[model samples]
Target: MKPEDFQFMSTMLKQRSGLVLNEDKAYLLESRLMPVSRAHNIKGVEELIAEIRKTNNEALIVEVTEAMTTNESFFFRDIKPFDMFKDHVLPHVLEKCAAKKSLRIWCAAASNGQEPYSLAMILKEEAAKLAGWKIEIIGTDISRQVLKKAEQGLYSQFEVQRGLPITLLVKYFDKQDDQWQIKPEIRSMVQYKYYNLLDSLTALGHFDVVFCRNVLIYFDQPTKGKVLEEISKLMPDYGMLFLGGAETVLGVSDKFAPVAGQRGVYALTGK
Candidate 1:
């Protein structure tokens, strides 16, 4: 890719999905977008970039963005965050929202649905306590392609193997030939939607707990702070935010502070 073309692609990705592509990652453009180029019969990535430059092709642009966006996810990607959610976060949120008997969770950059589905499985385990509660789990991602896969609730054998316990695997998933599909009960517990972190999140409404794990590392500092600030607006003082183990709110925003003993859990600042 030419310097100007790389700059154009990187700028478009940054604007569209808050993804910061540096010069070192220039090679990634060809590796990831080549399939998109072939799918559209555009010959190669350089041609694809040229075509995008010359036309206002929304579909092509969307395909390119989705191609570059990482959709790497697996069941319970990390054990620690899910453990925090089950042991500490859920209990607090349940207690705080007990009067209304309602709880809402948002999984930003939800990828292929494993994160939200993992939360659903945990909630299912505590069904007796939440028997009459109105539970809502909204899983949102920038790529509609992955969102579609998530809504289908199907996963390959390799996908189910990652970070998923055998006991819970047998309990929640039904094997359909080689692929495992989450049972309807668990599948119905979560909803998937296409959302960009760069866009306004107000329409998503309030969430008692949010799992925005493994996402912000791709963003620059300003974008990270802006996204965190916006997320803070959707939660109450008692609401919690779960970021990736590598991500933190410390220098990025004043809206949240780390939970006393938790590594990846954070509570609203003034709380």
Candidate 2:
């Protein structure tokens, strides 16, 4: 609530998660983190800030960071990337990796598991095409809360309806009272992990395609460029990167260049 409190939280988020919270976003402290305060038995934002300052509690700090960073994601979000994956990207990557009989994909900023699960459905549909190939999909997020939801593979009707066609819904998900759970076959195709883009990605192994969508928009330019480079490094020369429709790597970094005909797709410049 106080200017000093706002500045403290804004700096803390930027340092911990690369989140850029402008002064105008001070209201988000109350809107997003009040529940965190309530959970810790703090009275209000002012009291919460006071407690954080007084105690310097690491767990409490983590809780506040995770609470503030919880973002919303729906299945097949924005639609076009998944369509592109099904129509063009898969066919190309399949041909390119056919000799190896394997392909690896990473979905960064993969909230609540929808994006990777959507890809899993596509893989399920293309089982015949990938008959002997080994497929691996890893979904990563900063929030452990959403990762748990993702691991459970459950979704409400509203979530399933958004950008997810009725056919795929009926085919890949089964009704569970009021919610739908992804079939085991599809759910088994993906793995979820706690990862921060700021952390070293060496342990995850190289990926043939990386979907770091809609995430960079929250970072300042320096952080954005840093994350883009980190992602590009994990990609092999022939690997592809899919960013959000509104995001671009043109001025941010030279690790990648826009693909010839794809809107949000980029390929290593090999520079």
Q: Give Cα-based local distance difference scores for all models.
A: 0.92, 0.89
Compared with the true structure, what per-residue lDDT tens digits does model 2 show for residues 1-271?
7889888889989988988899887888889888887887888888988888899998888888888885788888888888899998899888889899899999998899999999999898889998989999999998888899999999998999888899999898999999999999889999999999889888888999999998998899998888888888888788999999889997999999998888899999987
Candidate 1, 69-110: lDDT as tens digits: 999988887788888888888999999999999999999988
Q: Model 1: clashing residue pairs?
A: none
Q: Cα lDDT for residue 106, model 2?
A: 98
Error of 2 at 16 (Å): 0.7
Regions more than 4 Å wrong, model 2? none
